[model samples]
Structure formats: C-alpha cells, structure tokens
Target: MSSNQAFESAKQEYEQWGINIDEVFKTLKNIPISIHCWQGDDVGGFEVNRGELSGGIDVTGDYPGKARTPEELRADIEKALSLIPGKHRINLHAIYAETDGQVVERDKLEPKHFEKWVTWAKEHRLGLDFNPTLFSHEKAADGLTLAHPDPEIRQYWIDHCKASRKIGEYFGRELGTPCLTNIWIPDGYKDTPSDRLTPRRRLMEALDEIFAEEIDKNYLVDAVESKLFGIGSEAYVVGSHEFYLSYALKNDVNCLLDTGHYHPTEMVSNKISAMLLFFDQLALHVSRPVRWDSDHVVTFDDELKEIAMEIVRNDALDKVMIGLDFFDASINRVAAWTIGTRNMIKALLFALLLPHCQLKELQENGDFTRRLALLEEFKTYPFGVIWNQYCQEMNVPAKESWLQDVQKYEEQVLSKRS
Candidate 1:
C-alpha cells in the first residue's frame, strides 16, 4: 500500500484512542530542538590556539572528513538540518568563535567573533544558543575551573563565562529569540578531596561574579549544568546536581540536566516533573550514555520516550529548553547529527500522539493493570507511519531516503576534505 493510505489507516487507529493526529502535527511543528554544532566536528571548535580535549570528557575514533573550519561546520549542519523535519535552533560553544587567525583569549572574546555565525543564522532564520567552554584550556588542566583553588584561575573562568553571556545576548538581540547561555564546568577532583565545601563555596562566589551584571532576560537566559561524575572526576564533582539545583533555585536561574551526566541507574526523565515544580524553566542536554558518561548519540529508547512523555504530558514543552549533546568521531559526522536529532524529534512525535490524559486518568483511578497493558500495546502502534507523514509534510526525505543524501554529500563534499 502507498504511504498516504497507510497513514490514513494509522490515523484511524490512533483517533480511536482520542488522539488528534492533526493537532499533534500542529504542536510538533512548533517544537524546536536545538542541534549542537559540535557533532559535526567532534567538539573540535575552530580556535587559533586549540588545545587537546580534556576535562574528563573524551571523543574517541579517528573519523576522517570531520569539519575543519567554521564554514565547513556550518555547511555540515545545513546538510543535517535539511534532512530533519521541523524548524530547529543551533547550540554553539564559545570555542567556535571566529577570530581571523588572531589569538583572542577566552576572557576577551566579544560578539564580533561570532558575527559570521549570526549572519549564517539570520540567513537560515534559525535561533542560536550559547555555552561557555570551560574545558580544554591550560587553566583547567587540573580538572578544575570555576572551583579552582587559585584566585587568578577562578577569575579567568569567571570572566570567560561573563563574556559568553554577552555573546549569547548578542545572538538573541540579533535573531529575535532569547538565547540560553549555559555554563558547564569540569570542576572536580580525581580522587578524594580534603575539603569539598571550599570548592563549592568558591564556585558559588565565582558564579556570582560572572552573573553580577544584569542583562535583559528577554535577550539571554542563564543555566547551570551539573554532573554526577566524569573520567577524572569519579570521586567528586564540584557541580553536583544538588549543588546546582540549590544554586539555580536560590539565584533564579535555570538548571540544566544532561542525560549522560547522571549515574547509570539515575534517570533524568524521572527528575523532570520534580524540577518543574520549583523552577520556572529548565534546560536539557539530551545525550545517550554508554555505561558511563560516554557521550554516545541518542537513540529512541525507553528513557528518551519517557523524557518526551514527561515534557508533553505535563505541558512543560515551552518550559523545558531541549538541546542535543553528543559527539561521536566513529561514524559519518553529518549522519550522526541527522540520526540523533531525528530520534529526538521522533520521541517528541511519539509523545504527542499518545493519549496522555487517558493514561493519567487510569493511574489516578488506580487501574494499574490497564495502564501497563495499554502502554505496552501502544508500543506496537504505527509510529513510523506518522513519522513518515511528518517528514513528507516538512518537505524532507522520508524513511531511509535521507541516508542516500548523506552518502552522496560525503562523496561530493566531505571525502575531498583533508
């Protein structure tokens, strides 16, 4: 049967469950996932004085044809965006700044360094988000940045973050969308520390200094991300979830949750509801963690679906700022962005098509047996049919047709890169 006929049959089945497929389409279209720019280049941003990837995070594999320049990275992102349905935003790190071969220190970075990016974003009519790159620098060689013991070192990072917020403000003012400027530091001890309180206190003070200047909330929204542990930070991380949660609450800033930043057993999906209760807004770095905090590309697994369900069912779609976060140098970088982002959108679409109200009622009524049964049965629903319809409606290649485009692009563009 043709795709349209299949979609009609699937629509009828979901409609029986009181699912408004048309309304689902409308809601899904407005949801914009922020695609990270690092995926195209394995987090290797274009800095004249680029350093090795450190801060307890690592990107393995020696994939060739990785984006080597800002222009190349932008082109790769455009290619991925063309394949994924729906309008989306691009998330950038401060290291992606273009300085014309000049040595612009992180603390001294200005909005002019990102003018090319703003121009490109304007051309595509896409929104931009920013992050302060607190890793891969000499000052952070000891695995501490904001919480560093040295007064000068802490001050340097503080300045960098402050500069990053201004750059984020610039993007928002130029693009007409508020920019989410997130600060994620790799501040932790490799082994046990004598005094954890000192570092936490230092971090708090540094953050206060960074956010001392009051920028318009309409231009930039600030967020702080926490981690359970990382490669060198297995023993202690300064920005623990509890630390940032309390800090975010007290300071009136958004707290960012990275899926891979939690313990293997801890589910970020479960924390969404609890967080929404206290904070007016939340940010997310949706990444797949393999056993540990290995930044693997996201898959449409149980947790991803649950996360999407929480956002949709609680009506926190606008409250939660969604952004992709993973860098795999193992495969085709462009395809990596396309696959991870498409799965994120797919999970949202799946959540949108579900009868969330009915499920909640079943639970509220204490009908546990029916709730479990219906949840399992809906897993077999024609989710793919609806996804294909979305891709078609969005004017992108449906099904596996997008892979062919990536392969062709690799042959024509990427393969030629040194």
Candidate 2:
C-alpha cells in the first residue's frame, strides 16, 4: 500500500483505543526543536582567524566541507531545516557573530554583531536562542570563568554574559519569540580543590551581578546549565546539577538539562517531573553520550524516548524548550543535523502514540501485571506508520529518503569547498 494508505490503516487501529492520531500529528508538527548552530561547524565558530576548541569541549574528526564562515554555517542550517519537518529554532553561540574582519572582544560584543543572524532567522520565520561563549578564550584557559578568583577575569565574563542577554533580547524582539539565553561555564578543577566553597560563592556572586539588569520577560528568558565533570576538570565542576537546580528555583530562571551532562546511570527523564514541579519551565540539550560527556550524535534511544514521554505524559509541551546539542565531525555535518533532529521528532511521536493515561491508571490502581502487559504491548504498535504519516503531512521525505538529498548536497555543494 502507499504511505497514506498505510497511515490510514494505523489510524483506524489506534482509534480502537480512543487515541486520536490526527490530534497527535498536529501536536508533534507544532513543537519546535532548536537546532544548535555549532553542529554545522563542529563547534568551531568564526570568531578568530584560527583557533582550537577549548574549555572542556572538543569535536572529533575532520569532516570535509565543515562550515568555515557564518554564511556557510547559515547555508548548512537552511538546508537541514528544509529536510526536517515542523517549525524549528536555531541555537547560536556568541562566537558565531559576523564580525567584519575585526577582533571584537567577547565582553564588547553587542546585538549588532548578530544583525545578519537576526535577519536570516526572520527571513526563514525561525526563532533564535543564544549562549554565552565562556570557554576557548584566554581568560577561560585557566579552567575558570564567572567564578575566577581574579576580579578582572570574573568581571570580563560577567560583561560578556550580560551582553549575551541583550543580544538574546534583540533576537526575540525582532523575531517575535522569546529567546533563551543559556549560561554554561566550564569552571572546575582538574584534581581536588583546596577550597570548593569559595568558587561556588564567587559564582553565585557573579551570577547576581550578571542578572542585576532586569529586562522585560516578553523578549528574553535566562537559563543556567550545569555539568557534572568535564575532560580536564574531572574532579569537580562548579555548576553541578544541584547548584543550577537550586539557583534556578531561587532565581526564577530555567535550568537546562543536557542529556549527556548527568551520570551514566541517572536518566534525565526521571528529573523532568521534579524540575517541572519547582520551575515554571525547563530547557533541554538533547544529545547522546556513550560515556561521560562525549557528545555523540543523538539517536532514538531509551533515554530519548523516556524524556519525550515525560514531556507528553505531563502535558508540559509548552513548559519545555527542546534543543539539540551534539557535534559529530566524523559524518556529514548537514546530515548529522537532519538525522539527530529527525530522531528527536520521531521519539516525540513515539511517546505521543503511547497509552499514557491507560498505563498511568493501571499503575495508580496497583494493577502491576496489566500495566506491564500494556507497556510491552505499546512497543509493537504501528508507531512507524504514524511517523511516516507525519513526514508525509509535513511534505518532507518519509523514512530515510532525506539522506539522499543530503548526499546530493554534499556532492554538489559540500565537496566543492576546500
């Protein structure tokens, strides 16, 4: 049968359970996943002539045709978005500013530095998100920023973060969407630290100063991200999950949870409900981490499914901002974006297809055996048929058909790049 015919069959089957497939498709198409810009360039932004990636972050492989300029990066993003179904947003770091052959210090960056990006996003009808590039700078080379003991160094980063907020506000105002400005500083010690409290205190004080200027909530929403540990800072990271969670609650800002930032055993899915209870909204950086914070390309794995299920089951789609954060230089950068994003969209569709209410009622009523049976049964449902239908409705290629387009682009466009 044809794709639509198959989907209709699946729709009829799901309707037997009182599930509205049409409504689920509508909801999934409306959800916007913010695609990170760094993935296009392998986390290498066009800030300086030539600079190596630092600050506890690194991208493996030397994939040819990696975007080397802001224009090239935007082109890759445009191509990726065309293949992915649904309205989407772009996540940009401050480092991607289109400076006209001048070394503008991070502390001195302004909204004008990103005028091109704002214009492009507007033209594409896409929303924008911003992040302060706290690492890969001389000041941050010491493995500390925003919490550095030196008054001068700490002040520099504070100013940069403040500027990022202003830039974020500008994007939101221009695009008619609230921009999320996330702060993730790589401040930690390689080995055991003599004093941990001092750094944490300094960080708290610096955050207070950065957020001293209050902007209207309509344009910008602030967030802070935490990491358990980084490559060099294996001992301790200043912005641990507990610190950000408490800070987010007390400061009335969102706490961004990167799927790869937590321990191996701990699942971000379990933490979503807890965060939702205390905070009005939550932010997510969805990526796959094999071990530690090794940001592998995202796949439709168990955690990804659980995370999506939590959001759907809680009815918190509006309360959460989903974004992709991964750099896989080993593969085609544009394809990487499409693959990861499509996987995320697929996972959400899978979650929406579940009999959440039925399963919950069983668990709540203590019908353990029935709950397990229902849970297992959901695995065999015709979710793929519905997902194919989603792609068809979105007018994007269904299944792995999008990969051929990426390959064509690679041959026609990417391979031509030096």
Q: Name the candidate that leads on lDDT.
A: 1
Per-residue lDDT for 262-318 in model 2, tens only?
A: 898989999999888888899999989888888999998889999999999999999
Give the backbone clash total of model 1.
Answer: 0
- What are the lDDT figures for the candidates, one per model? 0.95, 0.92
State the lDDT of candidate 1 residue by residue for 89-179, as single tens digits. 9999999999999999999999999999999999999999999999999999999999988999998999999999999999999999999
Q: Count the backbone clashes (under 3 Å) in each candidate.
A: 0, 0
Q: Distance (Å) between predicted and true CA of 47, model 2?
A: 0.9
The alpha-carbon deviation from the true structure for residue 319 of candidate 1, after best TM-score superposition, in angstroms, is: 0.6
* Model 2 accuracy (lDDT, Cα): 0.92
